[model samples]
Target: MLRPALLALFLTGATAPAFAQPPTETVPLLREIKQWVIGCDNLRNCHALSAPSGVDEEDYSSLTLHLWHQAGPQGYLRLRFDHRGEDVDLSTLLLDGKPLGLELTQDLHIELDDQGGDPEVQSFGGIEDAAARRWLQRLRNGQRLQLPGDEAAHVSLSGLSASLLLMDAVQGRLDNVTALSRPGKGAASEVAPRAPAPVLRKFTAAAPLTAEEQAGLVAAALQAVKPEEGEPEATVGALTAQQAMTVTRYDCAAYNCEFDVSSRERQAPYKETPMDLQPLPLEDAALQGSVGYDEASGTLSYFYKQRGIGDCGGGASWVFDGKRFQLSEFHRMPRCTGVGYGDWPALWTTVPAP
Candidate 1:
């Protein structure tokens, strides 16, 4: 199934410092334009990618086109091509089966990297405003984009125009000179300024839990979460009764499990509240993902994998500022186009509060 990226903000408590505020238009937006998907983050940075042709194909061999632009007068447009087979030769790139007779390296610098894990995968792309404009103009009306040698590795251009237009609108570049779809004589100064990323105050008071304390906490957490009535107790080897209980209650056999502090607050002396009062946010709150928590840093992370291969997903992390959990990082990749987790476009970022 094709997974559409869901957008939600988890606000921190009142104790968080007011170091910086997001843009007035802080709402994140995601839209599916035919075979393409576009998303704009809280800071107004927009990203669009070509969707894979088949959702059920397991090989994960597909050609993906990525376009990104930051929101501001000085922001430069960037483009990249990702392929799962091998490195792409830009000199042989084709638009509707016709060659683009232009010197690509003069305006853009392309770098090929192994992307670290799979030796068969490679990506290259970096083009500023002028090069980006020229490429966009050539591709705006095309039917298909063909890479060298690989007949199956081609991106559909059905919704390319509409996706670019939506990106321009989201970043307030419509009809302006910097617009990707609708360019005009309007000065670059007419574009909106980039919004400041929010700042988070870190808390360092958390102490690492001893082995005994950690085991006790895990038991207490499992007991607090009551198992559903009529549900048979799960059986697993090499696990204690408490561990089995945790597995059954959380369905950890199928999905991965980790600790989260948000579900249960710890008062002084390490007292835990009942599960009914504070259910796991991964299952109860609007956020949807498998959660993991680090006791040493007081950081809770949530990641939802769109598929088992883990090529696409949305994830966020928050830090506990001695009182509440403040969002520290957020990113999403709506399309399963072979983009790596580190390359996902960030929708929200934060720095340490002064």
Candidate 2:
């Protein structure tokens, strides 16, 4: 029952953009790298997903990669293909120029109430399976992966390592399981089983932002992105709060737009002086982007688009603990091209907790 439900939410996003609805906690976008987007639900289960660009929505839905993890036996990497409503034979899955053997007793067929044929989804290696465990290790080591049919097709392993780190932050003991489950390796001679992953705390929305409250946020945003030519001044813009504690200041000057975040409920007194925040590198200062908050996970996300079309963008996000914002994760992609969204091959890194 749980498996089918999880697949529904994940597959639904394949044809169209969708997130976990109410009753299911969610981190809207924990991380996105090229075609891959990693997200988590209230249950602490995380999915590393990818759907290539330039394909029909329904056709693309069946063609996807979902690496799932839940801190225990419920972890694995699976590939799904729609097959245009036909039975298909799958003998082996190839990754990084290597073939992973699979046991297929019969042709795979996915028919929803004998309706239109759905793509058949197959697992590469399960959490407890030796081959699956090995594949995970290779992925974390930054190895490239390719689908079975296309010899020229390859998926970059960039940011996968960091995305897993974010998943571990939500769930617990994933690092431990990976270490112990290393392929061709035995578990520690004497080790206790890890406890199950923790469920995320549910969040209740606070009062909606008032017009004045929104104004204060705009003022703060101006201060964050204002050029250093003169004193910071308030600018006209709109403020939208994705969550009670999270508000984004969106303002566009000419053809350029800027987004800044604020955690306070009300805007502070207008200050000619600047607020204390880390300055982004000179090269990344001019990109257009926005910020979002995931109330369920208490994570703050900052995203930006690179100057040209292709894979050349990056993101910086933090976790807020009432008092301060701590660096949670960051990604950089300097050499990516031909990507529709302007994000290229990138590397994701996790900031060690202080």
| lDDT by residue for model 2 (1-354), tens | 124553333322111122111111223234565556665543344556553433343223333334665332333334222222223343444556676444321222332422222223232222334544454565666555555664433455556666656555444333344332222232222112223222222223344566776576566655566553434333232112332343434454432345544444344553322222333332344223655666554566666655443234666655544434445444444333223221222122232332
State residue 234's C-alpha deviation in candidate 2, in Å.
9.7
In terms of lDDT, model 2 sits at 0.41
**Using Cα atoms with residue i matched to residue i, what is each candidate's TM-score against the true structure?**
0.76, 0.39
- State the lDDT of candidate 1 residue by residue for 1-354, as single tens digits: 111111211122112112121233334776678778776766677878887545766423467778877676666677877667755666677788887655653454445453354555556666766888788887889888876677768878889999888877776677778788888776777776666667777656444444554555555555555543433221111111121112223534334332333233222223433322112222224134476555556565677777766667787877666555677767676777776676676666556676
Model 2: worst 10 consecutive residues (lDDT sum): 14-23
Error of 1 at 8 (Å): 24
Q: Which stretches of candidate 1 lie over 4 Å from their true place?
A: 1-26, 56-61, 105-119, 226-249, 253-270, 273-289
Q: Pick the lDDT winner.
A: 1
Question: After superposing candidate 2, which stretches have Cα over 4 Å from the reference?
Answer: 1-151, 154-205, 227-258, 263-289, 293-299, 304-354
